[model samples]
Target: MEGRNKCAACFRQFNKMEHLVEHMRISYHSVHEPMCGICRKHCRSFESLREHLIGPLPKVDCERIFKDRGCDLCLTIFSSRNALWAHRSTCQFSRPNNAILYRMASLGIQDELRIDSSRGKAVALACKMVGGGSDGSLDLCARVCLVDEYERIIFHAYVKPTLPVTNYRYESTGIRPEFLRDAMPLKQVSRKIQDYLCNGEPIWQIRSRSGRARILVGHGLDHDLKCLELEYPPMLIRDTAKYPPLMKTSKLSNSLKYLTKAYLGYDTQTGIQDPYEDCVGTMRLYTRMRSLAHRTQDYPLATDPQNRNNYASWRQTELERMSPENLLELSRSDYYCWCLDSN
Candidate 1:
């Protein structure tokens, strides 16, 4: 017989014993471990944590409240339907237009742009804000730190704001006018960041060669990438904010501060925001998650072999015959997870 390694709780097979051990250590499967209040199943991460409560296979009991009280922006499940109605206005923002070229034009900054192709590795990044806008609008990135998987700083810079500083958000951001006086212009920062993310390959060519683009790991990446005026394929991004298992019961995102404290057992952003600290914390979280020995078969199939009918097109009897576990196994993740590639 061929040697086999499998997780007892989830029935996920692993190719090696060490991977099974690692998964057991992190999974902590027990009656006392954190579990989906609805599913009565232990979850490996908050992404899965929320998934059990709100996603495709959510419990019927939780589904009703979730639908009436879920906040799409923050992913919080409110106490009552009225509470959700009240919070929606505060949670969402009007989507910003492509801000890349406008930022360059407003700053009138120019610099030589170059790419360094050889340096290829995953990176964790964090952005510090300058202000929250004059009338409490959108915040701006004033500083950024990019730390490699090995915890070395590859790039760190104070970025000049393209928009006039409004509220400064000093208590949290710790930014001042002096910091921006000689800081790198937004245009220059954007170019350098682009080069780093793409290595030496043309951005347009990265899609053809999947490995050419360096992976970006961060929390609240949508806001940071927006402020930087940067675009990366969703496949290359490992965002803690949007990962389903790490989210809230209502399918909204959890705050980085809360996630760090709950999962990593530490406090962060207690005072002024330091991008380097955030970078390291974010990196640690990514490493911990990527180490999980998820079921390989659960990874999205590379190609469809069966002439299978769509779920909606299937007959009721066919659906009823399959167990809930089997149905969930057939579902696909909207984005990629490194666990899918792990051996």
Candidate 2:
């Protein structure tokens, strides 16, 4: 009867240890074959190859895929697959909405749902704002301007700082004296922001009356809201900073300067950012992104298998050329203006 174990190289079954030893001496003697005990990579001799594989040939991790679970968003590494699964189940970073949802919403027009009671005329209008931010107190440079259903400007003002900037580091961002000109004091700014919300047509009331939805537009809107110390529902705000499809495409640079260059074909930030220009850029980017989205259908899929393979091969070649470090540096260079901190 043949033995259960067989030599992988020769595929010869042996019934007895003596027979296997004899076969190794006779048949294997003519050929010099050294095998790594761990991975079976051939080397020179048993002792040398054993030392190379087992002693110190740069330990390569060969763990099974099931053993690894890592969070892709935050790059949180996990030891075991089960542990990774458990961590992902509770990790907000792994969620679908992630960081890019805000940007996607900003590209599309917001629908104002309202019913007209007096004239009984239901009207749907595209309402949006142009806003800007600068380095000041936590709230000094942040402001939102509201536009009506007719695209008429309704109200606008700087948000008041909630905390004093006595301890904050303002010079780090290179705040200029000219940038601070025409700035309202904290008290007055707060009153203005409040009055704009309360006294003037509240956004919800306008939506109700005009049967339209109000869209908040701004650059890096989270920072704007942070400065204002106001929290609007995510759907209400259209943050051009967060728009994803436009950002995913290489046409627009991540910074306002690059975006202005691409959309308006003009280089901005030659001096300080003009609040009005910044606002206009935000609107322009939104319009351009919306137009692009309207022109395209769903993401195109490869119809032919061979074509799909070729496309994937080309993409892999391009990606491999741009290593992780290269990609990170490219991202930093593209978004240095808006990127507050480095990794």
* Candidate 1 local distance difference test against the native: 0.64
98-191: candidate 2 lDDT, tens digit per residue: 1232232223212222233232111111211122334432234433344333322343333323443332222232233333334444456434
Q: How much is 322 displaced in model 2, in angstroms? A: 37
- Judged by lDDT against the true structure, how good is candidate 2? 0.37
Q: What C-alpha lDDT do the candidate models reach, one value each? A: 0.64, 0.37
The TM-score measured for candidate 2 stands at: 0.35
lDDT of 1 by residue, 1-343 (tens): 2344324422442233334333433333432123444445665455565555677776778666667776543345777888887876654332212245224423433334334444336788889886655585667888877877866566777788898887677788666676677788877887788777888667888767757678899999988999999877777888888875677766698888877765665677766667777787777667766765555543343233331233433343565465544444454433355665334
Instruction: List the pairs of residues colliding in candidate 2.
Output: 103-242, 103-243, 111-213, 112-212, 112-213, 113-212, 114-211
TM-score of each: 0.61, 0.35
Scored against the true structure, residue 152 in model 1 reaches a CA lDDT of 57
Clashing pairs in 1: 46-245, 46-246, 47-244, 47-245, 47-246, 48-245, 74-252, 75-252, 117-200
Name the best candidate (by lDDT): 1
Each prediction's number of clashing residue pairs: 9, 7
